[model samples]
Target chain A: MGSPAPERIVRFSGTVRLAHWLLASTFFVMLFTGMCLYLPALSRLVGRPTAKAWHLWSAIALLVGIAVLLLIGNRRSLTGVVRDADRLDQDDVAWLKGGPRRLFDHDDAPPQGRLNAGQKLNTMVMLGLMVVLAISGTLLWLGERDTTYRFGGSVLTHDLASLAIGFLVMGHLYLALVHPTTRHALRGMVVGDVDRAWAERNHATWAMSESVQSAERNA
Target chain B: MTANAPTPRPGGRPIGRAAFLGTVATGVGSIALLSRYSGSVQAAIQKVSAAVPGVNQIAPTAGWRIYTVADQMPTFNAATFKLKVSGHVANPVTLSWSEVDALATETQVTDFHCVTGWSVDKVHWEGFRARTLIDLVRPAGNARYVTFVSTEAPYVDQLTLAQFTAPGVMVAKKQDGVALKQEHGAPLRLVVPAMYGYKSVKWVGEIRFDAKRADGYWEQNGYDVDAFIGRSNGLTGS
Candidate 1:
């Protein structure tokens, strides 16, 4: 049909928004704190004492916060099933080819209600990164023991993971700050509200879902 | 240009510039607070000291059996191995596989703490006490620091002689009740439970003693050197 008015689009619920922001804030803290612990230049910026304390506490908080968010949020909506496994859906491929411009040209883009393909992909990648980091990190944290579980792979694996995670974080940061359409995405996290057009253009699938529709009707 | 590289702050200044004044203020405030509340500082020191790695938590049960070097097969051959210690030191000693293994033998049951924040109780590790090696070379009287260079490409750690010699610093060769698996330090590794896992440099290849301090791989990249558990070296302000 027609594009939903900016005021009409139902963005993430208050609880969902809260959970998202909590996780995001903790993630930022963990990133900075981790950097301080891993890289000397950042550590010098904060000074070792502060870096050490912030890194440890932030990590602990991030771990606990993410756990709570994982349980509280709707996991299914976050990770949609691939209806056709062996094939790349034409819709997704078209969106991928369109890149950033399509996201802004509302009419040309798919009717994404609450989350778009790009956002969905980011969410999944981030979730996987968190799990891998948490697991490997816990192993390294334990130090060398008689345990059977190995945390870091070879030194090369560990190095590569570090680089990968660093880049992932940079990507996450870029999405938040660089992309115009997604730039407002950060505001939704902070204030727990998104303009209707944002919800419609970015997360149509989520916005159109029964849960969201039902909530909007009830509201 | 990264998608998320930090952007300029609201005041038209860089994030670094914005953080500069605040960082200095925080630093001074912290120094004041630390001096005023010496107890906290002492507590921080104690907390870090205990976090050191190589404290074996899995106590040796009736079934546990310690193995000698001769009893086990060589997990890694010395032919291709090399230990290169470089950075802020008068003598950068690069030891061959044979040389590293030959240092006076010291063994201990110690724990390992990874930066991710986990601890393994106790495992037997065999190697030379880093201090003994330093004593032999007598790092110039000015050399007050030591850094462990890991064969692990791109990761290294600098340790103060005090931290290295605090106690139970063994270049690990054995773990649990058997020879160390290749996955572990294998041929040679450092086990200093007094610090975290990063401090226990694995696949160690070099030891550089110096009068000045330098950050290890993680420290240089984004980790704490003190790496004491429970207490943050204050890398994160809050």
Candidate 2:
């Protein structure tokens, strides 16, 4: 035919995109309600009980959503990302060590795959934050009647975790929306596909070997 | 107009503009001070209020978070303060400060529990029991519920007669042997020790004996009317 018809490559499957958005929405809901609970002035605006209830419910939704995502999500996509994020190659290490220049210049970067070293680190930290937040949040809720949880410093842990996640989310938003080089990658999350050319340029290591990884669940 | 000009109240001191502004500023500043610096700062502010004319502004008091509808808390003249009991009561009476104070009073040490997961332990609250007031008012046979209306408008709560007369319940005027600061619902606030903090209506100006329970401000805003410390509000764990 004309030119071997431009091969369509999918960056992320629909299942992966659904999971990402679900986590993001729940996170934002918790953040909004958490801020209302944290600040007294804000609490007065949106009654404390409302804020407390929303915070609790959203926290529950986040857990349940994660569980459901694990249960029904594409097994290959779920394990593939976690496996890729956990094991960093020499190129990922070198790309991370490239410092601030890595933001604008990917030339010095060792051939990156689906996710870079920075993203891997962010994923790990975010997971850790979720674990602590859930534990501390449960304790604080229980402390309502039994002060034992309060005595164990659940409030402090919850507050610190809140502060950390607040900042981490802001950084994540900046990269996803504002960072010149990384902003282009947001489409991969939004529509679940990206140009193979862009993938080749950004994630050369994965793009070259990506043909074996089909977009559909054929594997 | 003049600094010494007398207010309408018989024994009330005329609060000059400067003093009023100063009080308002202190209250606003105190409210701005976050609860993160709670224990020491709150104690110090309470000490100041104990010695000075209580700032009729909001402030975190002894770990108690203040909630009110008015933009600024209105100060009450204890010398001229009055509690009016009417509605479905057989005896409608407006008791002046002295009359209300003369009723039999008790000081009980109890922990104050807020639904928001904070508790202040062993607070000494001195006040006459709600039963004491109910006895004096003699609510009519038809009156099943009582509404505690706050001086702060749009902020009110309700309690059944039985709930109002519950043991450990009282109309608290003092906390820890000290007259209540404005932010703590000065002059008078209902103390429902068994329930969450919202049930305790602060700055109570009038007590209306009603035939039915009308949800208070918090209740209207989706808060449980019962407001038990652990049992209500969709909470399961004790």
Candidate of highest lDDT: 2
Residue lDDT tens for model 2, A74-144: 65675555555565666766777797787777665677777777776667666666766776677667655
Identify the runs in model 1 with alpha carbons over 4 angstroms from their true place.
Answer: A1-8, A42-53, A67-90, A100-107, A144-159, A201-219, B1-238
Backbone collision count in every prediction? 77, 0
Model 2 Cα displacement at A111 (Å)?
1.9
Residue lDDT tens for model 1, A127-161: 54454455455544443331223222321123234
True contacts kept of each: 0.00, 0.01
Worst 10 residues of 2 chain B by lDDT: B1-10
Could you tell me the lDDT of residue A91 within candidate 2?
Answer: 71
List pairs with backbone clashes in candidate 2. Answer: none
What is the per-residue lDDT of model 2 for residues B1-238, given as tens digits with 9 covering 90 to 100?
1101111111112222223344334333332332233345445656775566544123224345555566556578968888999899878999998898788999888877776545566788999887787788888898999899999888899999889888898899899889987777888888888898888989999999999879898777667788876677655543
